[model samples]
Target: MYPNDGFRELERAECLRLLAKVPVGRIVHTRQALPAVVPLNFRLDDDGSVVVRISARSELVRAIDGSVVAFEADEIDAGAQSGWSVVVTGAAAVVTDPAACERLARTGPQSWAPSPQEVFVRIRPELVTGRQLVGGRTLYGVDLPS
Candidate 1:
Protein backbone atom coordinates (compact mmCIF):
# COMPACT_ATOMS: atom_id res chain seq x y z
CA MET A 1 0.00 0.00 0.00
CA TYR A 2 1.10 3.58 -0.53
CA PRO A 3 2.32 5.25 2.62
CA ASN A 4 0.09 8.28 2.23
CA ASP A 5 -3.02 7.14 0.37
CA GLY A 6 -5.35 4.24 0.95
CA PHE A 7 -5.74 3.67 -2.77
CA ARG A 8 -3.47 1.00 -4.20
CA GLU A 9 -2.58 0.56 -7.82
CA LEU A 10 -3.81 -2.70 -9.26
CA GLU A 11 -1.74 -4.76 -11.66
CA ARG A 12 -2.95 -5.39 -15.19
CA ALA A 13 -3.87 -8.99 -14.48
CA GLU A 14 -5.67 -7.94 -11.33
CA CYS A 15 -7.53 -5.28 -13.28
CA LEU A 16 -8.76 -7.85 -15.78
CA ARG A 17 -9.73 -10.19 -12.98
CA LEU A 18 -11.72 -7.47 -11.27
CA LEU A 19 -13.31 -6.48 -14.58
CA ALA A 20 -14.45 -10.05 -15.15
CA LYS A 21 -16.31 -10.03 -11.85
CA VAL A 22 -18.49 -7.10 -12.88
CA PRO A 23 -21.29 -7.19 -15.46
CA VAL A 24 -21.74 -3.53 -16.27
CA GLY A 25 -19.42 -0.72 -17.42
CA ARG A 26 -19.48 2.74 -18.95
CA ILE A 27 -18.25 3.24 -22.48
CA VAL A 28 -16.74 6.67 -23.16
CA HIS A 29 -16.70 7.70 -26.75
CA THR A 30 -17.18 10.66 -29.05
CA ARG A 31 -20.68 11.50 -30.13
CA GLN A 32 -21.20 14.33 -32.65
CA ALA A 33 -17.82 15.88 -31.85
CA LEU A 34 -18.59 15.76 -28.14
CA PRO A 35 -17.60 13.17 -25.57
CA ALA A 36 -20.35 10.90 -24.30
CA VAL A 37 -20.64 8.12 -21.85
CA VAL A 38 -23.12 5.24 -21.95
CA PRO A 39 -23.63 2.61 -19.34
CA LEU A 40 -23.86 -0.91 -20.70
CA ASN A 41 -23.43 -4.49 -19.66
CA PHE A 42 -20.34 -6.21 -20.95
CA ARG A 43 -18.21 -9.31 -20.76
CA LEU A 44 -14.48 -9.92 -20.94
CA ASP A 45 -13.23 -11.87 -23.89
CA ASP A 46 -10.67 -14.60 -23.35
CA ASP A 47 -7.99 -12.19 -24.52
CA GLY A 48 -9.18 -9.46 -22.15
CA SER A 49 -11.11 -7.49 -24.73
CA VAL A 50 -14.41 -5.95 -23.67
CA VAL A 51 -17.44 -7.21 -25.57
CA VAL A 52 -20.69 -5.26 -25.52
CA ARG A 53 -23.98 -6.27 -27.06
CA ILE A 54 -26.32 -3.55 -28.24
CA SER A 55 -28.98 -2.97 -30.83
CA ALA A 56 -27.67 -3.03 -34.37
CA ARG A 57 -29.39 0.28 -35.03
CA SER A 58 -28.14 1.97 -31.90
CA GLU A 59 -26.46 5.28 -32.59
CA LEU A 60 -23.78 4.17 -30.16
CA VAL A 61 -22.85 1.32 -32.42
CA ARG A 62 -21.97 3.65 -35.24
CA ALA A 63 -20.43 6.24 -32.99
CA ILE A 64 -18.11 3.86 -31.20
CA ASP A 65 -17.18 1.35 -33.83
CA GLY A 66 -13.74 1.82 -35.36
CA SER A 67 -13.07 4.49 -32.78
CA VAL A 68 -10.87 4.70 -29.76
CA VAL A 69 -12.84 4.67 -26.52
CA ALA A 70 -12.60 4.13 -22.81
CA PHE A 71 -14.46 1.49 -20.81
CA GLU A 72 -14.75 1.76 -17.03
CA ALA A 73 -16.25 -0.57 -14.44
CA ASP A 74 -16.22 -0.31 -10.69
CA GLU A 75 -17.60 -1.84 -7.55
CA ILE A 76 -18.02 0.35 -4.51
CA ASP A 77 -19.41 -0.35 -1.06
CA ALA A 78 -20.66 2.90 0.37
CA GLY A 79 -21.27 1.40 3.78
CA ALA A 80 -17.91 -0.31 3.89
CA GLN A 81 -16.28 2.65 2.14
CA SER A 82 -14.16 0.45 -0.07
CA GLY A 83 -14.04 -0.87 -3.61
CA TRP A 84 -12.15 -0.93 -6.90
CA SER A 85 -12.33 0.68 -10.33
CA VAL A 86 -10.86 -0.42 -13.64
CA VAL A 87 -10.59 1.46 -16.92
CA VAL A 88 -9.66 0.10 -20.31
CA THR A 89 -8.83 2.23 -23.32
CA GLY A 90 -8.84 0.72 -26.76
CA ALA A 91 -10.18 0.74 -30.26
CA ALA A 92 -13.79 -0.38 -30.56
CA ALA A 93 -14.79 -2.51 -33.50
CA VAL A 94 -18.06 -4.12 -34.49
CA VAL A 95 -18.00 -7.86 -34.83
CA THR A 96 -18.86 -8.35 -38.47
CA ASP A 97 -17.73 -11.89 -39.07
CA PRO A 98 -20.74 -14.20 -39.21
CA ALA A 99 -18.98 -17.08 -37.50
CA ALA A 100 -17.70 -14.89 -34.69
CA CYS A 101 -21.10 -13.31 -34.33
CA GLU A 102 -22.67 -16.72 -33.99
CA ARG A 103 -20.12 -17.67 -31.37
CA LEU A 104 -20.72 -14.47 -29.43
CA ALA A 105 -24.47 -14.89 -29.62
CA ARG A 106 -24.12 -18.16 -27.81
CA THR A 107 -21.61 -17.00 -25.22
CA GLY A 108 -21.60 -13.21 -24.92
CA PRO A 109 -23.54 -11.03 -22.50
CA GLN A 110 -27.27 -10.93 -23.18
CA SER A 111 -28.69 -7.62 -24.28
CA TRP A 112 -30.78 -5.52 -21.92
CA ALA A 113 -32.92 -4.08 -24.70
CA PRO A 114 -35.59 -5.94 -26.58
CA SER A 115 -34.05 -5.53 -29.96
CA PRO A 116 -34.59 -8.10 -32.68
CA GLN A 117 -31.30 -7.15 -34.26
CA GLU A 118 -28.21 -6.82 -32.11
CA VAL A 119 -24.56 -6.42 -32.87
CA PHE A 120 -21.47 -7.16 -30.82
CA VAL A 121 -18.87 -4.44 -30.37
CA ARG A 122 -15.48 -5.59 -29.18
CA ILE A 123 -12.97 -3.19 -27.67
CA ARG A 124 -9.41 -4.34 -27.86
CA PRO A 125 -7.79 -3.49 -24.55
CA GLU A 126 -4.76 -1.50 -25.50
CA LEU A 127 -4.37 0.20 -22.15
CA VAL A 128 -5.70 -0.90 -18.79
CA THR A 129 -5.49 0.83 -15.40
CA GLY A 130 -7.10 0.20 -12.05
CA ARG A 131 -7.07 1.15 -8.38
CA GLN A 132 -8.43 -0.43 -5.23
CA LEU A 133 -9.49 1.51 -2.20
CA VAL A 134 -8.39 -0.30 0.90
CA GLY A 135 -11.23 1.33 2.69
CA GLY A 136 -11.84 2.10 6.31
CA ARG A 137 -13.47 4.95 8.18
CA THR A 138 -10.49 7.19 7.45
CA LEU A 139 -7.10 7.17 5.78
CA TYR A 140 -4.34 9.69 6.38
CA GLY A 141 -6.08 13.11 6.22
CA VAL A 142 -8.90 11.89 3.99
CA ASP A 143 -12.03 10.04 5.07
CA LEU A 144 -12.39 6.46 3.93
CA PRO A 145 -12.87 3.00 5.33
CA SER A 146 -9.29 2.13 5.75
Candidate 2:
Protein backbone atom coordinates (compact mmCIF):
# COMPACT_ATOMS: atom_id res chain seq x y z
CA MET A 1 0.00 0.00 0.00
CA TYR A 2 1.09 3.56 -0.69
CA PRO A 3 1.24 6.24 1.93
CA ASN A 4 -1.13 9.16 1.90
CA ASP A 5 0.69 12.47 1.51
CA GLY A 6 -0.32 15.83 2.82
CA PHE A 7 -0.33 18.96 0.73
CA ARG A 8 1.73 21.96 1.78
CA GLU A 9 1.92 25.55 0.74
CA LEU A 10 4.56 26.53 -1.77
CA GLU A 11 6.31 29.88 -1.89
CA ARG A 12 5.32 32.28 -4.65
CA ALA A 13 8.82 33.03 -5.86
CA GLU A 14 9.92 29.41 -5.77
CA CYS A 15 6.85 28.34 -7.69
CA LEU A 16 7.64 30.79 -10.44
CA ARG A 17 11.24 29.65 -10.54
CA LEU A 18 10.28 26.03 -11.01
CA LEU A 19 7.64 26.90 -13.60
CA ALA A 20 10.03 28.99 -15.64
CA LYS A 21 12.40 26.07 -16.02
CA VAL A 22 9.74 23.52 -16.93
CA PRO A 23 8.95 23.27 -20.63
CA VAL A 24 5.31 22.26 -20.55
CA GLY A 25 2.31 22.50 -18.22
CA ARG A 26 -1.38 21.84 -17.94
CA ILE A 27 -3.72 24.80 -18.01
CA VAL A 28 -7.11 24.07 -16.46
CA HIS A 29 -10.26 26.06 -16.81
CA THR A 30 -14.03 25.56 -16.86
CA ARG A 31 -16.07 25.16 -20.01
CA GLN A 32 -19.73 24.30 -20.45
CA ALA A 33 -20.08 23.32 -16.81
CA LEU A 34 -17.13 20.99 -17.12
CA PRO A 35 -13.40 21.19 -16.45
CA ALA A 36 -10.89 21.18 -19.25
CA VAL A 37 -7.16 20.68 -19.04
CA VAL A 38 -4.88 21.41 -21.94
CA PRO A 39 -1.15 20.88 -22.28
CA LEU A 40 0.62 24.01 -23.36
CA ASN A 41 4.06 25.38 -24.01
CA PHE A 42 4.52 28.22 -21.58
CA ARG A 43 6.93 30.97 -20.67
CA LEU A 44 7.17 32.28 -17.13
CA ASP A 45 7.14 36.03 -16.88
CA ASP A 46 9.13 37.97 -14.30
CA ASP A 47 6.00 38.94 -12.42
CA GLY A 48 5.01 35.39 -11.44
CA SER A 49 2.67 34.94 -14.39
CA VAL A 50 2.77 32.65 -17.36
CA VAL A 51 2.72 33.44 -21.10
CA VAL A 52 1.32 30.80 -23.38
CA ARG A 53 0.86 30.71 -27.13
CA ILE A 54 -2.07 29.00 -28.72
CA SER A 55 -4.17 29.00 -31.82
CA ALA A 56 -6.30 32.07 -32.31
CA ARG A 57 -9.59 30.18 -32.28
CA SER A 58 -8.73 27.47 -29.80
CA GLU A 59 -11.46 26.64 -27.34
CA LEU A 60 -9.09 27.25 -24.46
CA VAL A 61 -8.54 30.78 -25.65
CA ARG A 62 -12.25 31.45 -25.62
CA ALA A 63 -12.81 29.93 -22.19
CA ILE A 64 -9.76 31.38 -20.45
CA ASP A 65 -10.07 35.06 -21.03
CA GLY A 66 -11.60 37.07 -18.22
CA SER A 67 -11.87 34.02 -16.03
CA VAL A 68 -10.25 32.28 -13.11
CA VAL A 69 -7.86 29.59 -14.29
CA ALA A 70 -5.34 27.14 -12.92
CA PHE A 71 -1.97 26.37 -14.45
CA GLU A 72 0.39 23.57 -13.47
CA ALA A 73 3.90 22.68 -14.59
CA ASP A 74 5.99 19.70 -13.62
CA GLU A 75 9.24 17.91 -14.33
CA ILE A 76 10.16 14.40 -13.26
CA ASP A 77 13.37 12.44 -13.45
CA ALA A 78 12.67 8.79 -12.79
CA GLY A 79 16.28 7.71 -12.82
CA ALA A 80 17.19 10.13 -10.05
CA GLN A 81 13.83 9.93 -8.31
CA SER A 82 13.67 13.71 -8.21
CA GLY A 83 10.92 15.89 -9.54
CA TRP A 84 9.27 19.26 -9.08
CA SER A 85 5.79 20.65 -9.69
CA VAL A 86 4.26 24.10 -9.56
CA VAL A 87 0.68 25.33 -9.62
CA VAL A 88 -0.61 28.81 -10.28
CA THR A 89 -4.17 29.95 -9.82
CA GLY A 90 -5.16 33.29 -11.20
CA ALA A 91 -7.08 35.32 -13.77
CA ALA A 92 -6.40 34.94 -17.46
CA ALA A 93 -6.81 37.44 -20.23
CA VAL A 94 -5.88 37.78 -23.82
CA VAL A 95 -2.81 39.93 -24.40
CA THR A 96 -3.97 42.43 -26.99
CA ASP A 97 -1.40 45.07 -26.31
CA PRO A 98 0.95 45.21 -29.26
CA ALA A 99 4.04 46.07 -27.25
CA ALA A 100 3.57 43.35 -24.66
CA CYS A 101 2.73 40.75 -27.24
CA GLU A 102 5.78 41.73 -29.22
CA ARG A 103 7.94 41.39 -26.16
CA LEU A 104 6.50 37.96 -25.44
CA ALA A 105 6.87 36.97 -29.04
CA ARG A 106 10.55 37.80 -28.83
CA THR A 107 11.29 35.32 -26.07
CA GLY A 108 9.03 32.66 -27.63
CA PRO A 109 7.61 29.60 -25.93
CA GLN A 110 10.00 26.76 -25.16
CA SER A 111 7.76 24.19 -26.78
CA TRP A 112 5.93 24.33 -30.11
CA ALA A 113 3.20 22.08 -31.38
CA PRO A 114 1.24 22.06 -34.63
CA SER A 115 -1.09 25.02 -34.67
CA PRO A 116 -2.58 27.77 -36.79
CA GLN A 117 -2.31 31.49 -36.02
CA GLU A 118 -0.33 32.31 -32.92
CA VAL A 119 -2.51 33.35 -30.03
CA PHE A 120 -0.92 34.81 -26.93
CA VAL A 121 -2.51 34.18 -23.53
CA ARG A 122 -1.35 35.58 -20.23
CA ILE A 123 -2.23 34.39 -16.75
CA ARG A 124 -1.80 36.87 -13.92
CA PRO A 125 -1.04 34.78 -10.89
CA GLU A 126 -3.02 35.45 -7.74
CA LEU A 127 -1.46 32.48 -5.96
CA VAL A 128 1.38 30.14 -6.69
CA THR A 129 2.59 26.92 -5.01
CA GLY A 130 5.19 24.25 -5.59
CA ARG A 131 6.73 21.06 -4.20
CA GLN A 132 9.67 18.83 -4.91
CA LEU A 133 10.02 15.09 -4.56
CA VAL A 134 13.47 13.72 -3.89
CA GLY A 135 15.03 10.31 -3.17
CA GLY A 136 11.70 8.50 -3.56
CA ARG A 137 10.44 9.40 -0.09
CA THR A 138 11.38 12.95 0.74
CA LEU A 139 9.02 15.74 -0.19
CA TYR A 140 9.95 19.37 0.20
CA GLY A 141 7.49 22.16 -0.38
CA VAL A 142 7.89 25.91 -0.58
CA ASP A 143 5.29 27.80 1.38
CA LEU A 144 4.28 31.11 -0.11
CA PRO A 145 2.92 33.01 2.82
CA SER A 146 -0.31 34.71 1.97
- Model 1 clash pairs are 135-145, 135-146, 136-144, 136-145, 136-146, 137-144, 137-145
Regions of candidate 2 where Cα sits further than 4 Å from its true position = 1-9, 77-82, 110-116, 134-146
Candidate 2, run of 10 with poorest lDDT:
1-10
Model 2 Cα shift for residue 105 (angstroms): 1.6
Clashing pairs in 2: 10-142, 10-144, 11-142, 11-144
Instruction: Please write out the lDDT profile of model 2 over residues 3-46, one tens digit for every residue.
Output: 23544435677778778777788999999989989988788887
lDDT of 1 by residue, 66-141 (tens): 9999999999887888888889999999999999899999998899765998889999999998877766743224
Model 2, TM vs. native: 0.78
Q: Score every model by TM-score.
A: 0.85, 0.78
lDDT per model vs. reference: 0.88, 0.78
RMSD score of candidate 1 (Å) = 4.5
